[model samples]
Target chain A: MAFATKRLGKELTKLHGSLPPGIELVSAEGFEEWLLDIKVLDANPLYLNQTYRLKFKFSPSYPIEPPEVTFVNTKDRPIPMHPHIYSNGIICLDLLGSQGWTPIQNVESICMSLQSMLTGNTKNERPEGDQLFVANNRRRPRDIDFYYHDNTV
Target chain B: MVNAEQPPDPVRALEFKEKGNKCFQAGDYQGAEGFYTQAISHDPTNPLLYTNRAMALLKLSHYESVISDSLTALSLHPNNMKAHFQLAQAQIALHHEKDALESAKKAYELCMEEVMHGGKGATSLGPIMELVRRCRKEVWEGRERERTRTEKGLLGELVRDLEDRRDVEVQRLEGESAGEIQIEEVRQEYEGKIESLRGVFHRAGEVPRRRVPDWCIDDITFAVMDDPVVTKTGQSYDRSSIMEHLKRSPTDPLTREPLHVSDLRPNLALREACEEFLEENGWAVDW
Candidate 1:
């Protein structure tokens, strides 16, 4: 607990990195036992112009691994009830793949990937059994094993 | 309906006590409370009934009820050190500082005496001594801090804290902004140098009306332009007006296939056309 950790927030938000428009980093600082923040980004265009606060939980092992990310302050995005996404803000992406994780990735890259994923995919389909799946689950989303499907999506 | 098979008082009391302890271990404080309360009622004379019930209440964070139970225990048996220790904790919660100090003193006194006996000394008192010191220190610091805390009026001090907090936030934001500008500068520096097309998506738009650059027209040979098939390669080619690429990398004669226009091995006319396109667009054609 005594080990001090610092966020290079300023470094994370450069211009060429002018993140897919409308996403803003509101406030970020230490919380609970780890550091956290509320990031407001433009919602999926289907739910246009809305801002959603996503919670980021970075483990001691980050960069080498992706930070545990999720949606916190909910609005029109509907918490993205997909097979890979839980009501809590965990995302399963090939980039964050268990065996395929790349050490060079960062929050900026992850956010960009999320932006592209949201923009390119044009459906409102939830994971296989959305309602029952949500009801039965009690653990955080990162713990679930997802069967990612369809390259066309 | 009360099951007739249910055990009587002694057995039921033991059962509930064990059940309560089990639930407490499992982090089910609410279940523990219900069970301990039932067991205490079944055997009211046991000081331990009050003691365990108080601990259960304490675990539930029902501090006031813990004080009540501890006091009730002390009334039944005046020398109950556990009751005194728990009573001190509950008093602290209720802001009964003076009473907490007295009870903490009594508990510590009993423990200190036992420790002095140099035999049968309670090991639990090691931490309890720290607790007593912390409680007294808390009371002392409260008074010291309270006096200093309100050197100004409560509202004025709160307003000042709000303003100070705002100032700290403003400073942090300013720091972030300055950092962002630095990052932008660095990214710009990096962007200016690197022309490689990695993550860049081709921006789609209507074809611009600007005429194709004369450089493409001058450098490319006319024969490669008209025919889609044959090229400088002598290798048979394909497509219309590949004169654009032909000038850049003609082709291999025997193969007749257009030479790799840079890295891409497009056929004759197609290769010519690509060369013209890159020259006109001012892009690293190979890229």
Candidate 2:
């Protein structure tokens, strides 16, 4: 657990110099959380010319446990419409959950996953029952029991 | 120099330094600290990068980190006056006055050298000299406090050692007292056993009316003898008992071998052993 901060520090140092295409780090003040902006490279009509802000909150067990990641809506950034993303910004992506998370997946890899998710998406829709879940769901994203029927995304 | 594990690229490191400077000027101290750290990782040999980070961390009120960074900068380049000055300030804030004094003195010396060499005028040294003066007073007080702390620790150790010694002494005295009482109890028990044995000897009717041991008796006469002698058979008898037996055409009483009066010899050593035994156990004589 003490190595959590050290690992995150290395990730931050690596990310500071350069990031993967279509992903940029907006700010990383400490080991706790970071802000990133991601864009889909492909000309998908639903995601073209739009940059979505992602907030990553890391716990002391980071890398061992998945970081809590979600979309954050600012004036310049808007939430992308996707079958996995709720209207309120909770993403139901399997990779972001504990079951699918691995120590090998760093901030850059997660950003790339989101980028590809957006690039391959053709649906201009929020998750199923997005409005209802947003109003009633009090649990963290990792606590949600998401059924992964669409692995193609 | 600690992060010098990777080969350095001066050009890239300079780029990071420029970025850090920009961030620092824009009042983004944390960002500046990050960039400076990156620059150091790229080119740890550069002392200026560490000093720059120390400055940024100082602004962020990260006095501890400022102290460490400044120390690293000074270690990499001992003549870096700004690093020494920054370290002094950080040490002062951390209440490490003794350490701050040395740093301030070095900074002041370097400043004086610069002015002496026409690098800066005397007017620039005023602030540094003031810092040096303040550090000197604080360092003296800090040393006194440290001395008092060490003295108190030594006194505590001494008191504990004395208490331990006292405990050992008390235990030893108690053990000796218990041992003495045990010895007296064992002696009394043995005395009772000896008295009971005396009663048994009295009831047996074999006790001599005179207080003499059985070993002092002449075998032939069955009475205590004043003089002991050995027959040719190596058996000792009283002088008069054997003399009387020989006169009665006697062989050795124990060996049944023919013997004359001349064959008897004085057993002086046995007589001396018997005398010593009788002297030490006169009560056994009657028993």
For every model in order, what is the number of clashing pairs?
A: 22, 0
| Local distance difference test, each candidate | 0.54, 0.74
Deviation in angstroms for B120 in model 2? 64
lDDT of 1 by residue, B1-287 (tens): 12355434756776888898898889888898888878766666667777878888888789989998998899889878889998988888777766887898688667655644553435555445545545655565566457545643554555555556555655665777767665555555444433222122112223356444332331112111212344353334322113223333353323434444332233455546644464344322111
Predicted structure 2, TM vs. truth: 0.35
Alpha-carbon DockQ of candidate 1: 0.03
Best candidate, DockQ: 1
Per-residue lDDT tens digits of candidate 2, residues A75-94?
A: 97999999998988888887
Give the docking tier of candidate 1: incorrect
Q: State TM-scores per candidate.
A: 0.32, 0.35
Of candidate 1 chain B, the 10-residue stretch with the lowest lDDT total is B218-227
Per-residue lDDT tens digits for candidate 2, residues B1-287, read 54546788888889999999999999999999999999988988888999999999999999999988988888889898889989998999888887887888788668757754658535545456556646655665565567667766665565566556555655665777757665555556545655665565446534346444556755543433434788766778755446545554446655546777667778888767665654444443222
- Report how far off residue A109 is in candidate 2 (Å): 0.2
